[model samples]
Target chain A: MDNPNLGGEPGSLSPGITVLIPAYNEAESISDTVNSLLAQTVQPAAIIVVDDCSTDGTAEVARAAGATVVRPPKNTGSKAGAQNFALPLVETVWTMAIDADTTLAFDAVEKLMVALDEKEVAAASGFVVPRYVRTVWERGRYVEYLFAFSFLKPVQDFFGKPLIASGCFSAYRTDALRALGGWSNRTMTEDIDLTWRFYFAGWQVRFVPDAVSYPIEPHDFKFMRKQLRRWSHGFVQNVRLHWRRVLAVPTLRMIVAVAAWDAMVASLALVVLLPLMIVLFSAPILMVAYVADLPVVLAPILLGAIRRRETARALASIPGFLVLRAVNAFFLLEAIWSELIVGRPLRLYEKGH
Target chain B: MGIPVITAISVIFYILMALTILPILRAVQAIRRSPRGAGRPHVFPLPVLAFLMLIGIVGGAWVVATLAVYRLAEVVPNVRGLLPADGAEFVLLGIGAVSMVGTLILVLSAVEVLSWFCAEREPKHARGPDGQKVRPTDLIQGGVHSGRPHG
Candidate 1:
């Protein structure tokens, strides 16, 4: 079949861009995702969705939407495994990774290409806005994502170390990705790991804020917790794997910020101590003491909320988002302690993805 | 010296040890049942394992020390009320902390096993007519479906 996006006869021109979607049991969303791709202004040379042995008719829906589907012999692993399945199939110079439940904006692909074409850019990751956020938890996540995408990522890019590339809409220069040995199959947050790997290899990644994709957020607390726990564990694992790079370049603002914040937040002593501070000290005294340390404690949260207005509103609902942050903090501490002190191999799937 | 102290110490130690052993036993059983070399057991590096063991030991010691303090308080009339009404709360907190740490270790070990298994059994490479790895782009053009289709 001739691809109109390549700007020539099918056989005459090489595939310039290939979009890969890693899917598993996404029957409800696959068709719309494929249709969105089909409706792209600058279409991909081809679309390949790697079905990770979904019992649902995800493969059939993808096929009907005009995407070529490939199912692995066995469920190889998780999202990373599915992407690895599609890596060998990409014949294009650039490959875009889009989640099955996400819909890309019409110009997302074109903008990604433009960003990748820039000098020294190894990969281009786009912004993800939550498509359906019905519950309070989902709304909170929507806010968190905005801060991550808009403020934090851009700041990280300026420092030359982007922490994560949203899996929903990320593009990679094939050569750079292949040289880095594709994606690590063992990690849950492969996109984050890959971003760090590219950074360590001295490859520059760009944040294309204009390139957008709408992804489904968890509608309830249970699903939200599962997602956050997986992400928290994955973040901890990646830190263990790349602590050397982080330590070597201690001057990077984002690195310093993450280390400082994570250390303070994850200290079990701090959580237990904070409540004690309230109990042992008078409320007035505690409030004064906290105010004295307000900048450090409240900076990330307030800045995070301001940058993501939707998230700010979501944070307002729970009165403090303390439970969310505390649970997330606990998991982060657990992950770090497990990997570093307990000599545990970071398990990505035990939390039941 | 008394039975109550010894009983408390033994019960606490046994519970801690069992918590540690359960996951390790499950992991070892999993490794043994898999076909030989089908999956490698996930093991923390020696240095890392040593560090974790040290933490576990220190944590275990803290539990013993707390129990010893409580026992001493019980035996000595002068220091009996020194710990205050929240004494039990502190003891519970200590146990809870140690249990959480132990649980984290178990989870880490489990993840290591699963990661090793997944890496070992990655899908076979799809080869082309030239014996080169088949590119997805090529397969799409060739229109030949190869691999077992899912039901």
Candidate 2:
């Protein structure tokens, strides 16, 4: 990889593009992720790998592979904390935050760059599609992501208030990033935190679906549970934290409020209420509720699968998504219970496999 | 309606109504919150309008089917005997129509989802106030940016 100390002038391809990869014990995947970034059509001015005080040779491997590796004196506790360690070192006008385990498309950076050109776009993120589809959890997430990115995100983008700028593969103007205090540690999901903050501050965030990034997701139930817990809690936490400011941003407030209501109520409707109604009342006709949203769910999954030419995979995964959705209700319910009802903060940063 | 039956009916009724209203409410909210004027909101874009139409048709079909079933029950000896009260026919319509509506919503929602496929994923840009270029840095300093983000 040629050292891309690239020139930063107007019209220059990625003139001041600096890529920041936040990692902890990512030795197995760090080098590959770094290589993919280096191989991008538009090379970044610098690639800084923040090892986050990993016990593994993650830092050594990254440095050996030619990335300017930075390991904080102590563990930053989360991916956001790790990314913040390298913020001061950023000299370029633009910064791309890439997760250590994720790899980007060749033209992903180029596509994201287009958003940065527009002054309103504070951060532009690529679509995240999982690299593996073998596990039930992975397949379920694939469907979830498909529905989210393919249908949900476009609407959010249309309103110009995409709920998130997506942390895994997103670009932000460096100066703008610092002003918001970089990746915040206030929430477990820093990407969501930063995205909402940007929106509240009157900055625009873009979702470029074509600029794809692949990150390996949890393949087993144990890891899936942890990931879901953090995510669910993080979502509710953000709502609690930002509801006031979110209201000020019209579309964002409504989208988030509705999403929160759905997360809380849908679980009750699907997991608890459905069974209780049938078991107690013995209303055989009420069974319709169980399959009522089938079209709504299946339509997006099948269409997404057909577009990717994975109709069979989508079909096979439909059942998996159903199971996952039920399980999601349980975990989400627990998160809401713990975070909101019990009033306990989930402080530990448990890495979801 | 019997006490338990009334509770069941009310539960089913409100849940269905909630299901139906949630998305529409969201769409309208999307428009209201949109930086663009009410002339067009992202939620009610052409495709979404078509989806709303299909749902409306489904709701309309349920009303007609319920009325038909109510009339049919009056003529059938066994069905008529099942309704012992003066308002029994109305109760029958409520039960019958809701179930039909549920089925219609299921089918149409599937159709609605099917219409959504892979998007072009292009970034659409709009200028801020005074036609001046507003950047993220500017927003940090409180730039005059609009609500519609790059679509």
Candidate 3:
């Protein structure tokens, strides 16, 4: 095969990393994303952009910025579909999925590649911090990522499983990805679907904190709703889909159980019970339960901020976090009701940001 | 508040923090010893210690309140007959019941989701990303082809 997408001969690329950017109408941000990959400490074998029939000249911009562009005959409808279109062309040993709106730290690829040195690791994901943190939604996600990546994720990793190797910037062994048939579109979040599948197959996925990627998060309520709805439904759908196989994986089972409990019970406590108590018991103090976990949440945020020297920025974002948490609780409850009770699952792949 | 009441609350706060944060410290030690984590600078940060303490305090308070309620119920003649004799045993029983219920829900949901998966069959003409029709074997074999709409 000519393998024109790659430089030199196919499979001859050293370090063996082929980057896949599944894009649709991402001309505005696609150049920066591709440029970031080009400037990596460990240059990728090829940066292939699967232009999912974007009318905005996304393919042109990416091609201009040194990426090999391929367009699908039709709009693939989801990121997974677009990636799958480009999967067969990956001649390198490792296949990485990077969101069109995300950029990586200069050494991000270098850091993440270390974990793939371990044969057991089928896929590895880096730490993700929002690229811009000015808007309320962005700020809220900034704090949320800091807390999750710093605290919960490490514990999960220590137990030999990190929940989901985040979708935005994760690398997988090409063989592993092909054997599993690429990312699945059956669930709202293909990344979670793929990660759980990896677990069931007895393959390991890793979380590399040193390797960091910055993804542009939803900056306003309009975009946040699209992102949160998909995420909430994705989570519930995965639990329903993988609950059987999950029972055999000890760490994963415990993680899912606690997550489900918290998602269902804690959301009820915050969204419904808290308001009901305040109204019926005439005890406004019960509202304190809404922000009771703030101190604990802040602990991880502060640590993550201190490492990045953004303590003040993190502290200023605390209010945003609280607001986002409340909003998250409501969406989770809605998703549970919609998927489990109403039997209506979200099937559209709307752009999150 | 009276000085005594303020002092008592402070004391309880510290106790809760201690109980919760202590286990985290132990976990950190184990992580530091692991081959992958040895000498990692941020293994045990102060915020984690502080956060765990806060969680401990909140969780401990809940446990304490539950035990207190049990004690209160025992003193009431009407409710006294309802709870088991030992307050500790009663709390354990409550915990076991909740766990059992949660487990049952998980198992039932798993069965439901699996049945749905089993019954789900793609239409004869559904084309996958590569322009090939998705097969039923692909579904059971983990991930060869996915025909559903993406989210």
Candidate 4:
């Protein structure tokens, strides 16, 4: 599996790899991200940061940190468009999609290449750890990453389809990516959408737990709520687009089954129950009734605790997390209703804080 | 018993629903018709539809309630008598009139929001190196600033 002609030698360097960072108003973190990439052991041939018309000096910071900055005409609606805008500019054989707010490990690129080479994989996604986990919301997201990276992704991979490849850190074989018409500009969850598309196009995606990238997690309630809302809307949008694909592909059966179960049972359950929980807490009698039903509810929590001790600790932030979840569910329900009944697309904007 | 009044209310409700539902239907159809793998439509029409539906249901209920009160006034002799001696019937009519107007405004606003949603644009074309219809990657020359030194 060696290509000596394309600067590839056995246990030697391969062709240049391009790290594309799509940034939108990430002035606070762009410099650090660039610096981290500069320090990488397997240095990227180019670091292209697509600044989507940031009003702030995000492009400047990226430039100062030694990334080649390309500014879009305006915010092109999403990160997908930004990548699409920069795809032609990338000359490297491999491209790594790195978020502007995320800092990659020094060995991240090397580790990804090892996985890609060994498995003959078309794409590989690395682990995303939260940069600051001091806050409750951040801690919850840390647990979420653990569940995703350690448990869920493995399960998804075993089923022959990975549900989501985080946009924070993912490497792709340039040819394979370009052949799929690049990322779809219309999708909010383009990362997840592209992963599925790549899989369907006969490309296997490997998960490299060692190739770590640290992304800033939402530290406050408002930010967390907005983040969750965007994620929920994106999830709905992705599901709507891929529902037919999952049905058409036999290999995707288990993955589709698990996703359906999660969407229907877990997502809907949280949405319905959160609102009810709020209402119940407002009433003394209903609160007492809920307390009596605690055993039924606590069983799942207890089981989760036994299975994943770290997750149990994270779940202690349940009150705040539930509030965020309820907010997200409200937006998700609205988005779903709009998509299913009204026949409209879902719009998720990161307009304000 | 007033046929004209009932007819007017029903017409308004239908009109409201039509104004609210038509654009959303159009947006949805557009999304369905668009190419596959393009991603979720911009959710342009749904939010508007949902908002309108909420207002229509709530406002319609309020209108119905007011109409019911008027009917009560007509049915119960004591209730009619308890009303203001002068122009009390007109006052009840005025309340219904205001409610109907309010409903119309609510429906109209919903339509406005829906229109805004539908107006959202899709991603524009990616330009090439020669200012032609090009792939997105052509914009990157010499692999994104090769001359720049690493930090």
Candidate 5:
């Protein structure tokens, strides 16, 4: 590994923030990720890349691109563990974590810094759209992000609970993070686990809409399946782990309840009842229930797309979103069955994108 | 999330559809095709209008089925006795149930749309260290930054 010398521009390093990138065989993409951070308007005090025992030369690439590269003695197993390995070295006031494949807008860090201006905010996350939109899976995720970040997240932020500070790109106050013992690998998703812990600890997390990052999404079904499986298990695992603590937080409890309803009950209705009713009543028209909410769903999606000036893209992605929704329902049910009913859990962390 | 005004409008639209089923469908298509003022917002795009037409067609079919059931109940004394309420009451009751369910599912989005109108400001937290104040030399000595490449 190269020395921790400033590698991009000589004077790009600013004080108060250190960025951490956990890489595992990300040689192809780490340079762009590192350079994106180096190009930030409010530069990080240091950029540390935890190469996490990649067989590929991820360390060399990341180091060459201006990040101080460190390799764990062995694989950390999960992204959470890799991030935890480097967490102790973050000495700045703020510690940011970005995926090795993600790139930020020039002002992303600067805008996220605004959220931390509030003393109560323990962490902040930004809007995320997939870096590519060509694939069906990617287009589905793109629409999902636009709707979620533009609509759902803003409301959650307004209510002082933005569900989860997204893992792909987020910043945290160093002290607050250390106090919580860094990101937890107890669940499939370390970011949400940490965010919920912050809530339980009486801290706040903000969603800064202006701070945007783009990460490469899974372009094929195999990768999408892996990503979806992890995410599905992660949500169920977090709910089980934090149900008690969540109940103590009013808005958070409601949010979790609603999400559970959608994931479990509503999904069941869509998968089971729709088919059953159609067969029983011989009423094919009942199929409209599958898309009855289109009127309501389209309103927010169109509005969100209009804001991004991607109305055509959003419209074209609708079919992809529908297909993804069906796939998502199946995965959620599988997760519930496996985790809750079958008493088995998904403990392995595999990167799909 | 709080229930927003759109949810109410959506519920009302459904009820209006049930009340004047087929006629309302034509009226909707007519209004969608009608030209508006130059400065007005294009609330319904072509795709959205098409979706509404699909919903309208299906919803109209359901309403026709309900009317057929109402007529059956009128002729059959046993069927009329089996029903808890009159045909009109029963149809409204079904709509009410659907509306309630829709509201439950859509409250999150409703509040989100509502939030667009109400801009809530983030409260400023206590001031932390000023990044501009700290020099690169200061950061280097903090043990994290190594200024030179290693041999």
Candidate 6:
């Protein structure tokens, strides 16, 4: 789709949206993030990188990359805080919150904008794929995203509510986002929070699976642990906070509840129940029971990855996903135990690499 | 084991089962190779050595004694000569431990292989405008660098 009318000339592209990237010490990726947005097929009218008190020259790098730099007077510790800090400066009818570490497909914005024609659609997100898939953590995330976006997202979209308008690469109706106070910092996950609020405000969220965004997934175990912890805590926090209000929407409530239940069961099974069974029953052969799940998980990945390149990558990454599942289970159980049983709410917001 | 069911359904099921084994094989191979980032050798963390120590000690004992119990017994027909004169439960314990240790190693290998895969790949080359090669810092407008200096 040609956006010739949406050219870079000032006052040329009327009602054109702006890109807002929130960054903190992302000097390495800031330029690439901005450049990718600038190179989009449906080019945004403006790109603003909100620097959240970086020790590095993030602001200068962003400015050099053609993104107008906006820094809070003081450090906005969390990603949501930084995005909210720059929300007022957004003048366009539509605005996108692209993370500094993410790059999008050339036609991502073009595809995302397609769903917004329905006036009720408040937000649209593209599929998320990892930029770097070399590391175990990265490969695991690659498969995780592949399964979630390719399989789960389509089903969620059919029911008219995506689990989230993923934070990394999503466009929002400027007014609708502002109405919810521009990504609440009440939870560690602003994306989930904002998406639920949009539904609560009677706005629809769409997921365009074809529009892909590649963000750097965590590579190291330390980084992965931090990310998983934040994610687990954020999920529980949102569930605890939104459960009362979200129950009003039947489809969303059912989906969220089921997902939560499944996660709990699966986590317990992998990390606790299975091991306990093996020890108690002296069942060494039962250990292979995990092998049964291989096809169930890999089928969707292979189906999603029709291309030769993606198929090979998916095949290579399957083991990593198994590792990730155990890690996820461990973290989820820890989060639930800490938050629900121990009555210790996870209040810290640590950004994933 | 059961009836010889050679229908298309069984054939397809076997084919899928065979395909699933490919990933398990690849995972085994990945951990065997030393990981490299860019052109440099990547060292496995100290924890890998720690895991290997446990597996080696436990697996080594089981393999040695199990060999004595099974292999020697088959050849000599006198297991007590090789192993201690023990209860039948001891024999069961030896076999069970061997299988359990074998399975444990497989599980741990999958994790170690992933750790190798998860190590960060070094950036190939920093790029300048119009697709020209540039210094890493030059790619960033402010000349900010994160790692050991490179192209």
Best by TM-score: 3
First chain TM-score for all predictions = 0.83, 0.93, 0.96, 0.81, 0.94, 0.95
Residue lDDT tens for model 3, B1-151: 3323433554466477656555664564456345653434444554456445644545444344444444666687665554433333323323433453455457546645645565535565556678877666565555545643433
Candidate 2 residue A176 Cα shift, in angstroms, is 1.0
**Steric clash pairs (candidate 4):** A87-B137, A88-B136, A88-B137, A88-B138, A89-B137, A89-B140, A343-B28, A345-B41, A345-B43, A346-B43
TM-score-best of 1 and 4: 1
Q: Is the docking of candidate 5 incorrect, acceptable, medium or high quality?
A: incorrect
**Weakest ten-residue segment in model 4 chain A by summed lDDT:** A1-10
Model 1 lDDT, full chain set = 0.62
Regions of candidate 6 where Cα sits further than 4 Å from its true position: A1-14, B1-151
Model 3: DockQ against the native?
0.05
Cα DockQ of the candidate 5 complex: 0.03
**List of clashing residue pairs for candidate 6:** A135-B117, A135-B118, A136-B117, A136-B118
Better of 4 and 5 by DockQ: 5
Those runs of model 1 whose alpha carbons end farther than 4 Å from true positions after fitting are: A1-15, A249-260, A263-270, A282-323, A348-353, B1-151
lDDT for B105 in candidate 4 is 55
Taking the tens digit of each residue's C-alpha lDDT, what string does model 3 give over A164-268? Answer: 999999999877777677888888899998898888888999888889999999999999999999999999999888877776676687677667876887777
lDDT by residue (tens digit), candidate 2, A1-353: 01122223323333478999989999999988998888888888999999888888999999987899888899988888888878777888898999888988898888778768877778988788888888889988888888787667766776687888887889998777777778877777888888998887789898777788999898999999889888888888888887667656666765675566557766766677667865765543344444445545565556657867988887877767777888998877888889899899787878887
The docking category that best describes candidate 1 is incorrect
4 or 5, greater by TM-score? 5
DockQ of each: 0.01, 0.05, 0.05, 0.01, 0.03, 0.01
| Each prediction's whole-model lDDT (CA) | 0.62, 0.71, 0.77, 0.63, 0.74, 0.71
Q: Give the root-mean-square deviation of each candidate in angstroms.
A: 18.5, 12.3, 11.8, 19.1, 14.8, 21.6
Model 6: which docking level applies? incorrect
Candidate 6 per-residue lDDT, tens place, B1-151, comes to 1112212323344344444434432332343232212221233432343334334433334333333344555687654453433323333443444455455555445434544465455556765455566566554545433333554
Error of 4 at B20 (Å): 53
Off by over 4 Å in 4: A1-14, A118-120, A273-328, A351-353, B1-151
